[model samples]
Target: MERAFVVLGAIFGVAGTAAAAAASHITGAGSGLDTAANFLLFHAPALIGIALLVKTGTVHANIGRFGGLLVLVGVALFSGQLALRALADASLFPMAAPAGGTTLMIGWLLVGLAALVGPRRV
Candidate 1:
Protein backbone atom coordinates (compact mmCIF):
# COMPACT_ATOMS: atom_id res chain seq x y z
CA MET A 1 0.00 0.00 0.00
CA GLU A 2 2.87 2.37 0.74
CA ARG A 3 4.41 1.53 -2.59
CA ALA A 4 1.06 2.02 -4.26
CA PHE A 5 0.74 5.48 -2.79
CA VAL A 6 4.26 6.44 -3.80
CA VAL A 7 3.79 5.15 -7.32
CA LEU A 8 0.46 6.89 -7.73
CA GLY A 9 1.94 10.09 -6.35
CA ALA A 10 4.80 9.99 -8.81
CA ILE A 11 2.41 9.36 -11.68
CA PHE A 12 0.23 12.25 -10.61
CA GLY A 13 3.22 14.57 -10.34
CA VAL A 14 4.44 13.75 -13.81
CA ALA A 15 1.00 13.93 -15.39
CA GLY A 16 0.20 17.18 -13.61
CA THR A 17 3.46 18.79 -14.68
CA ALA A 18 2.88 17.79 -18.27
CA ALA A 19 -0.70 18.98 -18.18
CA ALA A 20 0.36 22.27 -16.64
CA ALA A 21 2.82 22.85 -19.45
CA ALA A 22 0.12 22.09 -21.95
CA ALA A 23 -2.36 24.31 -20.19
CA SER A 24 0.06 27.24 -20.23
CA HIS A 25 0.20 27.00 -24.00
CA ILE A 26 -3.57 27.15 -24.32
CA THR A 27 -5.11 30.56 -25.01
CA GLY A 28 -7.45 30.66 -22.02
CA ALA A 29 -5.71 30.15 -18.72
CA GLY A 30 -8.94 29.17 -17.01
CA SER A 31 -9.45 26.11 -19.15
CA GLY A 32 -10.49 22.97 -17.32
CA LEU A 33 -7.13 21.48 -18.20
CA ASP A 34 -5.39 24.08 -16.08
CA THR A 35 -7.64 23.44 -13.14
CA ALA A 36 -7.17 19.71 -13.43
CA ALA A 37 -3.42 20.14 -13.62
CA ASN A 38 -3.41 22.23 -10.47
CA PHE A 39 -5.47 19.66 -8.58
CA LEU A 40 -3.15 16.88 -9.64
CA LEU A 41 -0.14 18.92 -8.62
CA PHE A 42 -1.59 19.78 -5.24
CA HIS A 43 -2.71 16.26 -4.40
CA ALA A 44 0.44 14.51 -5.52
CA PRO A 45 2.48 15.56 -2.51
CA ALA A 46 -0.36 14.80 -0.15
CA LEU A 47 -0.53 11.24 -1.41
CA ILE A 48 3.19 10.86 -1.02
CA GLY A 49 3.02 12.28 2.47
CA ILE A 50 0.27 9.82 3.37
CA ALA A 51 2.53 7.00 2.28
CA LEU A 52 5.41 8.37 4.32
CA LEU A 53 3.28 8.93 7.39
CA VAL A 54 1.80 5.46 7.23
CA LYS A 55 5.27 3.97 7.05
CA THR A 56 6.55 6.09 9.95
CA GLY A 57 3.55 5.70 12.26
CA THR A 58 2.56 9.35 12.00
CA VAL A 59 -0.80 8.43 10.54
CA HIS A 60 -3.11 5.50 11.17
CA ALA A 61 -2.09 2.98 8.53
CA ASN A 62 -5.47 1.55 7.49
CA ILE A 63 -7.19 4.92 7.38
CA GLY A 64 -4.37 6.58 5.52
CA ARG A 65 -4.27 3.82 2.92
CA PHE A 66 -7.98 4.03 2.23
CA GLY A 67 -7.87 7.81 2.09
CA GLY A 68 -4.92 7.75 -0.26
CA LEU A 69 -6.84 5.39 -2.52
CA LEU A 70 -9.67 7.83 -2.71
CA VAL A 71 -7.33 10.65 -3.55
CA LEU A 72 -5.78 8.63 -6.33
CA VAL A 73 -9.12 7.59 -7.76
CA GLY A 74 -10.50 11.10 -7.46
CA VAL A 75 -7.60 12.66 -9.30
CA ALA A 76 -7.89 10.11 -12.05
CA LEU A 77 -11.57 10.74 -12.54
CA PHE A 78 -11.51 14.52 -12.12
CA SER A 79 -8.43 15.18 -14.16
CA GLY A 80 -9.45 12.63 -16.72
CA GLN A 81 -12.74 14.41 -17.25
CA LEU A 82 -11.18 17.85 -17.48
CA ALA A 83 -8.42 16.83 -19.80
CA LEU A 84 -10.86 15.09 -22.10
CA ARG A 85 -13.21 18.04 -22.04
CA ALA A 86 -10.54 20.64 -22.71
CA LEU A 87 -8.67 18.75 -25.38
CA ALA A 88 -11.35 16.72 -27.04
CA ASP A 89 -14.29 18.90 -26.10
CA ALA A 90 -16.07 15.92 -24.69
CA SER A 91 -17.30 14.84 -21.27
CA LEU A 92 -16.05 11.72 -19.65
CA PHE A 93 -19.58 11.51 -18.34
CA PRO A 94 -22.41 13.82 -17.38
CA MET A 95 -21.04 14.60 -13.92
CA ALA A 96 -17.58 13.09 -13.75
CA ALA A 97 -15.93 16.35 -12.72
CA PRO A 98 -18.27 16.99 -9.83
CA ALA A 99 -18.16 13.40 -8.67
CA GLY A 100 -14.40 13.42 -8.74
CA GLY A 101 -14.23 16.69 -6.87
CA THR A 102 -16.49 15.30 -4.20
CA THR A 103 -14.42 12.16 -3.93
CA LEU A 104 -11.29 14.24 -3.59
CA MET A 105 -12.76 16.25 -0.72
CA ILE A 106 -13.98 13.13 1.02
CA GLY A 107 -10.51 11.64 0.76
CA TRP A 108 -8.94 14.74 2.29
CA LEU A 109 -11.44 14.68 5.09
CA LEU A 110 -10.47 11.11 5.85
CA VAL A 111 -6.82 12.05 5.84
CA GLY A 112 -7.59 14.84 8.27
CA LEU A 113 -9.49 12.37 10.41
CA ALA A 114 -6.47 10.11 10.42
CA ALA A 115 -4.33 12.99 11.59
CA LEU A 116 -6.78 13.98 14.28
CA VAL A 117 -7.02 10.47 15.64
CA GLY A 118 -3.27 9.89 15.51
CA PRO A 119 -1.56 6.52 14.98
CA ARG A 120 -2.26 3.50 17.08
CA ARG A 121 0.29 2.91 19.81
CA VAL A 122 2.68 -0.02 19.39
Candidate 2:
Protein backbone atom coordinates (compact mmCIF):
# COMPACT_ATOMS: atom_id res chain seq x y z
CA MET A 1 0.00 0.00 0.00
CA GLU A 2 2.81 2.36 0.82
CA ARG A 3 4.43 1.44 -2.47
CA ALA A 4 1.21 2.11 -4.30
CA PHE A 5 0.88 5.53 -2.74
CA VAL A 6 4.48 6.31 -3.68
CA VAL A 7 3.82 5.32 -7.28
CA LEU A 8 0.64 7.37 -7.45
CA GLY A 9 2.32 10.39 -5.93
CA ALA A 10 5.15 10.17 -8.45
CA ILE A 11 2.76 9.80 -11.37
CA PHE A 12 0.72 12.84 -10.34
CA GLY A 13 3.82 14.90 -9.69
CA VAL A 14 5.17 14.22 -13.18
CA ALA A 15 1.88 14.66 -14.95
CA GLY A 16 1.06 17.88 -13.12
CA THR A 17 4.47 19.30 -13.92
CA ALA A 18 4.12 18.39 -17.57
CA ALA A 19 0.64 19.82 -17.79
CA ALA A 20 1.69 23.08 -16.16
CA ALA A 21 4.52 23.39 -18.65
CA ALA A 22 2.22 22.60 -21.55
CA ALA A 23 -0.29 25.16 -20.34
CA SER A 24 2.40 27.84 -20.40
CA HIS A 25 3.16 27.05 -24.03
CA ILE A 26 -0.37 27.98 -25.02
CA THR A 27 -0.50 31.55 -26.29
CA GLY A 28 -4.16 32.42 -25.86
CA ALA A 29 -6.30 32.77 -22.77
CA GLY A 30 -6.47 28.97 -22.36
CA SER A 31 -7.50 25.78 -24.03
CA GLY A 32 -8.97 24.42 -20.79
CA LEU A 33 -6.70 21.40 -21.20
CA ASP A 34 -4.31 22.81 -18.67
CA THR A 35 -7.02 23.38 -16.15
CA ALA A 36 -8.51 19.98 -16.76
CA ALA A 37 -5.15 18.26 -16.76
CA ASN A 38 -4.10 20.03 -13.59
CA PHE A 39 -6.89 18.48 -11.62
CA LEU A 40 -6.40 15.04 -13.10
CA LEU A 41 -2.65 14.89 -13.21
CA PHE A 42 -2.02 16.71 -9.95
CA HIS A 43 -4.85 16.35 -7.47
CA ALA A 44 -5.56 12.80 -8.51
CA PRO A 45 -2.16 11.72 -7.35
CA ALA A 46 -2.36 13.66 -4.12
CA LEU A 47 -5.70 12.12 -3.30
CA ILE A 48 -4.38 8.70 -4.20
CA GLY A 49 -1.47 9.22 -1.88
CA ILE A 50 -3.89 10.10 0.87
CA ALA A 51 -5.87 6.98 0.15
CA LEU A 52 -2.68 4.97 0.27
CA LEU A 53 -1.92 6.41 3.65
CA VAL A 54 -5.32 5.34 4.83
CA LYS A 55 -5.16 1.90 3.24
CA THR A 56 -1.74 1.06 4.61
CA GLY A 57 -3.37 1.04 8.05
CA THR A 58 -1.42 4.10 9.04
CA VAL A 59 -4.69 6.02 9.28
CA HIS A 60 -6.86 3.03 9.90
CA ALA A 61 -10.36 4.30 10.53
CA ASN A 62 -13.67 3.75 8.82
CA ILE A 63 -14.17 7.44 8.13
CA GLY A 64 -10.78 7.70 6.56
CA ARG A 65 -11.45 4.75 4.32
CA PHE A 66 -14.77 6.16 3.24
CA GLY A 67 -13.27 9.55 2.66
CA GLY A 68 -10.45 8.11 0.60
CA LEU A 69 -12.88 6.21 -1.58
CA LEU A 70 -14.99 9.32 -2.06
CA VAL A 71 -12.01 11.42 -3.03
CA LEU A 72 -10.75 8.77 -5.41
CA VAL A 73 -14.07 8.51 -7.18
CA GLY A 74 -14.44 12.25 -7.29
CA VAL A 75 -10.99 12.69 -8.82
CA ALA A 76 -11.67 9.98 -11.37
CA LEU A 77 -14.89 11.61 -12.43
CA PHE A 78 -13.68 15.18 -12.19
CA SER A 79 -10.48 14.62 -14.15
CA GLY A 80 -11.56 11.78 -16.39
CA GLN A 81 -14.72 13.52 -17.58
CA LEU A 82 -12.99 16.79 -18.30
CA ALA A 83 -10.19 15.09 -20.23
CA LEU A 84 -12.72 13.14 -22.25
CA ARG A 85 -14.72 16.24 -23.04
CA ALA A 86 -11.72 18.31 -24.09
CA LEU A 87 -9.79 15.62 -25.93
CA ALA A 88 -12.80 14.14 -27.70
CA ASP A 89 -14.90 17.29 -28.00
CA ALA A 90 -17.81 15.10 -27.11
CA SER A 91 -20.59 15.70 -24.67
CA LEU A 92 -23.36 13.26 -24.68
CA PHE A 93 -24.77 14.70 -21.52
CA PRO A 94 -24.49 18.43 -21.09
CA MET A 95 -24.61 18.02 -17.32
CA ALA A 96 -21.52 15.81 -17.15
CA ALA A 97 -19.10 18.50 -16.10
CA PRO A 98 -21.42 19.84 -13.46
CA ALA A 99 -21.84 16.36 -12.08
CA GLY A 100 -18.09 15.97 -11.90
CA GLY A 101 -17.74 19.25 -10.08
CA THR A 102 -20.36 18.20 -7.60
CA THR A 103 -18.56 14.94 -7.03
CA LEU A 104 -15.37 16.83 -6.26
CA MET A 105 -17.14 18.97 -3.68
CA ILE A 106 -18.56 15.89 -2.05
CA GLY A 107 -15.14 14.30 -2.01
CA TRP A 108 -13.71 17.25 -0.14
CA LEU A 109 -16.55 17.04 2.33
CA LEU A 110 -15.76 13.39 2.87
CA VAL A 111 -12.16 14.23 3.59
CA GLY A 112 -13.34 16.72 6.14
CA LEU A 113 -15.49 14.10 7.71
CA ALA A 114 -12.54 11.78 7.93
CA ALA A 115 -10.49 14.44 9.65
CA LEU A 116 -13.27 14.91 12.13
CA VAL A 117 -13.26 11.19 12.78
CA GLY A 118 -9.53 11.42 13.38
CA PRO A 119 -6.79 8.86 12.76
CA ARG A 120 -6.57 5.49 14.45
CA ARG A 121 -3.49 4.41 16.37
CA VAL A 122 -1.21 1.77 14.91
Candidate 3:
Protein backbone atom coordinates (compact mmCIF):
# COMPACT_ATOMS: atom_id res chain seq x y z
CA MET A 1 0.00 0.00 0.00
CA GLU A 2 2.78 2.38 0.90
CA ARG A 3 4.63 1.52 -2.24
CA ALA A 4 1.50 2.09 -4.28
CA PHE A 5 0.99 5.51 -2.78
CA VAL A 6 4.61 6.46 -3.30
CA VAL A 7 4.47 5.40 -6.91
CA LEU A 8 1.26 7.30 -7.47
CA GLY A 9 2.70 10.37 -5.83
CA ALA A 10 5.74 10.27 -8.05
CA ILE A 11 3.60 9.86 -11.16
CA PHE A 12 1.35 12.73 -10.21
CA GLY A 13 4.27 14.97 -9.35
CA VAL A 14 5.92 14.39 -12.71
CA ALA A 15 2.65 14.69 -14.62
CA GLY A 16 1.79 17.91 -12.83
CA THR A 17 5.10 19.45 -13.81
CA ALA A 18 4.61 18.42 -17.40
CA ALA A 19 1.08 19.78 -17.41
CA ALA A 20 2.29 23.09 -16.05
CA ALA A 21 4.93 23.30 -18.72
CA ALA A 22 2.39 22.41 -21.39
CA ALA A 23 0.07 25.09 -20.14
CA SER A 24 2.83 27.65 -20.38
CA HIS A 25 4.26 26.66 -23.75
CA ILE A 26 1.46 25.13 -25.75
CA THR A 27 -0.41 27.51 -27.99
CA GLY A 28 -4.22 27.68 -27.43
CA ALA A 29 -3.96 25.69 -24.21
CA GLY A 30 -6.89 26.53 -21.96
CA SER A 31 -7.18 26.98 -18.21
CA GLY A 32 -8.27 23.38 -17.93
CA LEU A 33 -4.67 22.29 -18.20
CA ASP A 34 -3.63 24.71 -15.49
CA THR A 35 -6.43 23.56 -13.23
CA ALA A 36 -5.53 19.92 -13.80
CA ALA A 37 -1.90 20.65 -13.02
CA ASN A 38 -2.81 22.43 -9.82
CA PHE A 39 -5.06 19.62 -8.67
CA LEU A 40 -2.41 17.01 -9.39
CA LEU A 41 0.29 19.01 -7.63
CA PHE A 42 -1.86 19.61 -4.58
CA HIS A 43 -3.13 16.06 -4.12
CA ALA A 44 0.14 14.25 -4.73
CA PRO A 45 1.57 15.17 -1.34
CA ALA A 46 -1.69 14.54 0.43
CA LEU A 47 -1.79 11.01 -0.97
CA ILE A 48 1.74 10.43 0.27
CA GLY A 49 0.82 11.72 3.72
CA ILE A 50 -2.18 9.41 3.85
CA ALA A 51 0.08 6.50 3.03
CA LEU A 52 2.47 7.44 5.82
CA LEU A 53 -0.32 7.93 8.29
CA VAL A 54 -1.82 4.57 7.45
CA LYS A 55 1.50 2.79 7.56
CA THR A 56 2.37 4.31 10.93
CA GLY A 57 -1.04 3.50 12.39
CA THR A 58 -1.53 7.16 13.11
CA VAL A 59 -4.99 7.13 11.61
CA HIS A 60 -7.80 4.72 10.83
CA ALA A 61 -6.23 2.61 8.15
CA ASN A 62 -9.41 1.77 6.32
CA ILE A 63 -10.52 5.38 6.18
CA GLY A 64 -7.14 6.57 5.05
CA ARG A 65 -7.01 3.94 2.36
CA PHE A 66 -10.48 4.80 1.15
CA GLY A 67 -9.56 8.47 1.09
CA GLY A 68 -6.44 7.70 -0.85
CA LEU A 69 -8.47 5.75 -3.37
CA LEU A 70 -10.82 8.64 -3.77
CA VAL A 71 -7.93 10.99 -4.34
CA LEU A 72 -6.58 8.79 -7.07
CA VAL A 73 -9.93 8.42 -8.77
CA GLY A 74 -10.68 12.10 -8.46
CA VAL A 75 -7.38 13.05 -9.99
CA ALA A 76 -7.90 10.65 -12.85
CA LEU A 77 -11.38 11.83 -13.60
CA PHE A 78 -10.96 15.55 -13.01
CA SER A 79 -7.50 16.09 -14.30
CA GLY A 80 -7.77 13.43 -16.91
CA GLN A 81 -10.88 14.92 -18.45
CA LEU A 82 -9.46 18.40 -18.40
CA ALA A 83 -6.21 17.36 -19.96
CA LEU A 84 -8.06 15.44 -22.62
CA ARG A 85 -10.24 18.41 -23.39
CA ALA A 86 -7.37 20.85 -23.42
CA LEU A 87 -5.14 18.74 -25.63
CA ALA A 88 -7.62 16.92 -27.78
CA ASP A 89 -10.61 19.23 -27.61
CA ALA A 90 -12.77 16.43 -26.31
CA SER A 91 -14.26 15.36 -22.99
CA LEU A 92 -14.70 12.11 -21.17
CA PHE A 93 -18.49 12.31 -21.06
CA PRO A 94 -20.55 15.01 -19.40
CA MET A 95 -20.05 16.31 -15.87
CA ALA A 96 -16.83 14.35 -15.38
CA ALA A 97 -14.90 17.29 -14.00
CA PRO A 98 -17.62 18.31 -11.57
CA ALA A 99 -17.93 14.75 -10.36
CA GLY A 100 -14.19 14.51 -9.96
CA GLY A 101 -14.05 17.80 -8.11
CA THR A 102 -16.75 16.65 -5.74
CA THR A 103 -14.96 13.39 -5.22
CA LEU A 104 -11.77 15.25 -4.38
CA MET A 105 -13.60 17.41 -1.85
CA ILE A 106 -15.04 14.32 -0.23
CA GLY A 107 -11.67 12.62 -0.26
CA TRP A 108 -10.06 15.51 1.57
CA LEU A 109 -12.90 15.52 4.06
CA LEU A 110 -12.35 11.83 4.67
CA VAL A 111 -8.68 12.46 5.35
CA GLY A 112 -9.68 15.07 7.91
CA LEU A 113 -12.14 12.64 9.38
CA ALA A 114 -9.44 10.04 9.66
CA ALA A 115 -7.29 12.51 11.56
CA LEU A 116 -10.18 13.21 13.90
CA VAL A 117 -11.07 9.55 14.46
CA GLY A 118 -8.09 8.86 16.74
CA PRO A 119 -4.75 7.09 17.23
CA ARG A 120 -3.10 10.15 15.81
CA ARG A 121 0.48 10.86 16.85
CA VAL A 122 -0.16 14.56 17.05
Candidate 4:
Protein backbone atom coordinates (compact mmCIF):
# COMPACT_ATOMS: atom_id res chain seq x y z
CA MET A 1 0.00 0.00 0.00
CA GLU A 2 2.71 2.40 0.92
CA ARG A 3 4.53 1.75 -2.31
CA ALA A 4 1.32 2.19 -4.22
CA PHE A 5 0.71 5.60 -2.68
CA VAL A 6 4.23 6.60 -3.50
CA VAL A 7 3.71 5.71 -7.14
CA LEU A 8 0.38 7.46 -7.30
CA GLY A 9 1.86 10.50 -5.62
CA ALA A 10 4.69 10.55 -8.13
CA ILE A 11 2.23 10.37 -11.01
CA PHE A 12 0.15 13.25 -9.74
CA GLY A 13 3.30 15.22 -8.91
CA VAL A 14 4.58 14.81 -12.43
CA ALA A 15 1.27 15.84 -13.90
CA GLY A 16 1.07 18.89 -11.68
CA THR A 17 4.61 19.89 -12.59
CA ALA A 18 3.90 19.46 -16.26
CA ALA A 19 0.75 21.53 -16.07
CA ALA A 20 2.64 24.29 -14.30
CA ALA A 21 5.27 24.27 -17.01
CA ALA A 22 2.61 24.34 -19.71
CA ALA A 23 0.97 27.25 -17.95
CA SER A 24 4.11 29.27 -18.59
CA HIS A 25 3.72 28.69 -22.32
CA ILE A 26 -0.01 29.33 -22.43
CA THR A 27 0.49 33.04 -23.36
CA GLY A 28 -2.67 34.17 -21.65
CA ALA A 29 -1.81 34.99 -18.05
CA GLY A 30 -5.12 33.66 -16.83
CA SER A 31 -4.95 30.28 -18.47
CA GLY A 32 -6.27 27.75 -15.95
CA LEU A 33 -3.11 25.69 -15.73
CA ASP A 34 -2.30 27.07 -12.34
CA THR A 35 -5.67 26.01 -11.09
CA ALA A 36 -5.12 22.56 -12.50
CA ALA A 37 -1.60 22.26 -11.11
CA ASN A 38 -2.59 23.39 -7.66
CA PHE A 39 -5.46 20.94 -7.49
CA LEU A 40 -3.35 18.09 -8.80
CA LEU A 41 -0.71 18.84 -6.21
CA PHE A 42 -3.36 18.87 -3.53
CA HIS A 43 -4.61 15.43 -4.57
CA ALA A 44 -1.17 13.86 -4.88
CA PRO A 45 -1.20 12.78 -1.26
CA ALA A 46 -4.71 11.53 -1.56
CA LEU A 47 -3.53 9.20 -4.28
CA ILE A 48 -1.01 7.82 -1.82
CA GLY A 49 -3.69 7.40 0.74
CA ILE A 50 -5.79 5.56 -1.77
CA ALA A 51 -2.95 3.16 -2.42
CA LEU A 52 -2.67 2.58 1.27
CA LEU A 53 -6.32 1.75 1.38
CA VAL A 54 -5.87 -0.75 -1.39
CA LYS A 55 -2.99 -2.46 0.37
CA THR A 56 -4.69 -2.75 3.70
CA GLY A 57 -7.89 -3.90 2.11
CA THR A 58 -9.44 -1.12 4.09
CA VAL A 59 -9.13 2.53 5.02
CA HIS A 60 -8.90 4.48 8.23
CA ALA A 61 -12.66 4.56 7.86
CA ASN A 62 -15.34 4.09 5.26
CA ILE A 63 -15.87 7.81 5.17
CA GLY A 64 -12.26 8.38 4.26
CA ARG A 65 -12.50 5.88 1.46
CA PHE A 66 -15.61 7.57 0.14
CA GLY A 67 -13.99 10.94 0.58
CA GLY A 68 -10.99 9.90 -1.45
CA LEU A 69 -13.28 8.77 -4.24
CA LEU A 70 -15.13 12.04 -4.11
CA VAL A 71 -11.90 13.99 -4.22
CA LEU A 72 -10.79 12.18 -7.34
CA VAL A 73 -14.11 12.84 -9.02
CA GLY A 74 -14.12 16.45 -7.91
CA VAL A 75 -10.65 17.14 -9.23
CA ALA A 76 -11.50 15.53 -12.55
CA LEU A 77 -14.64 17.57 -12.99
CA PHE A 78 -13.19 20.81 -11.72
CA SER A 79 -10.04 20.64 -13.80
CA GLY A 80 -11.79 19.17 -16.80
CA GLN A 81 -14.40 21.91 -16.69
CA LEU A 82 -11.74 24.60 -16.78
CA ALA A 83 -9.87 22.88 -19.54
CA LEU A 84 -13.07 22.52 -21.51
CA ARG A 85 -13.85 26.19 -21.11
CA ALA A 86 -10.38 27.06 -22.29
CA LEU A 87 -10.27 24.73 -25.29
CA ALA A 88 -13.91 24.92 -26.41
CA ASP A 89 -14.27 28.60 -25.49
CA ALA A 90 -17.52 27.61 -23.90
CA SER A 91 -18.39 26.68 -20.31
CA LEU A 92 -21.29 24.34 -21.08
CA PHE A 93 -21.98 24.47 -17.38
CA PRO A 94 -20.04 27.15 -15.57
CA MET A 95 -21.43 26.04 -12.22
CA ALA A 96 -19.86 22.61 -12.43
CA ALA A 97 -16.47 24.00 -11.48
CA PRO A 98 -17.62 25.37 -8.15
CA ALA A 99 -19.64 22.25 -7.47
CA GLY A 100 -16.54 20.18 -7.97
CA GLY A 101 -14.59 22.50 -5.68
CA THR A 102 -17.19 22.02 -2.99
CA THR A 103 -16.94 18.26 -3.34
CA LEU A 104 -13.17 18.52 -2.91
CA MET A 105 -13.57 20.31 0.41
CA ILE A 106 -16.06 17.77 1.61
CA GLY A 107 -13.79 14.93 0.56
CA TRP A 108 -10.85 16.42 2.42
CA LEU A 109 -12.97 16.86 5.48
CA LEU A 110 -14.07 13.24 5.31
CA VAL A 111 -10.48 12.10 5.05
CA GLY A 112 -9.62 14.12 8.11
CA LEU A 113 -12.52 12.58 9.96
CA ALA A 114 -11.35 9.15 8.94
CA ALA A 115 -7.96 9.90 10.42
CA LEU A 116 -9.62 10.92 13.62
CA VAL A 117 -11.64 7.72 13.61
CA GLY A 118 -8.48 5.67 13.07
CA PRO A 119 -7.82 2.77 10.73
CA ARG A 120 -9.51 -0.57 10.89
CA ARG A 121 -7.60 -3.38 12.54
CA VAL A 122 -7.67 -6.96 11.33
lDDT per model vs. reference = 0.88, 0.61, 0.86, 0.72
Candidate 4 residue 115 Cα shift, in angstroms, is: 1.0
Clashes of each: 0, 0, 0, 1
List the candidate 3 regions with Cα displacement exceeding 4 Å.
27-30, 120-122
lDDT-better candidate, 2 vs 4: 4
Residue lDDT tens for model 3, 1-122: 77798799889999999998998888235668988998889888878888999898888888888888888888979999999989898999899999998998888888788878956444
In Å, residue 46's CA in model 3 sits off its true spot by: 1.3
Worst 10 residues of 1 by lDDT: 24-33
- Model 3 whole-model lDDT (C-alpha atoms): 0.86
Considering TM-score, which of the candidate structures 1 and 3 is the better prediction for this target? 1
Q: Candidate 2: misplaced stretches above 4 Å?
A: 1-29, 52-60, 120-122
For residue 93, give model 2's deviation from the true position in Å.
4.2
What lDDT does candidate 4 reach at residue 94? 64
Q: Which regions in candidate 4 have their CA more than 4 angstroms from the true location?
A: 1-11, 53-59
Candidate 2 has what TM-score? Answer: 0.66
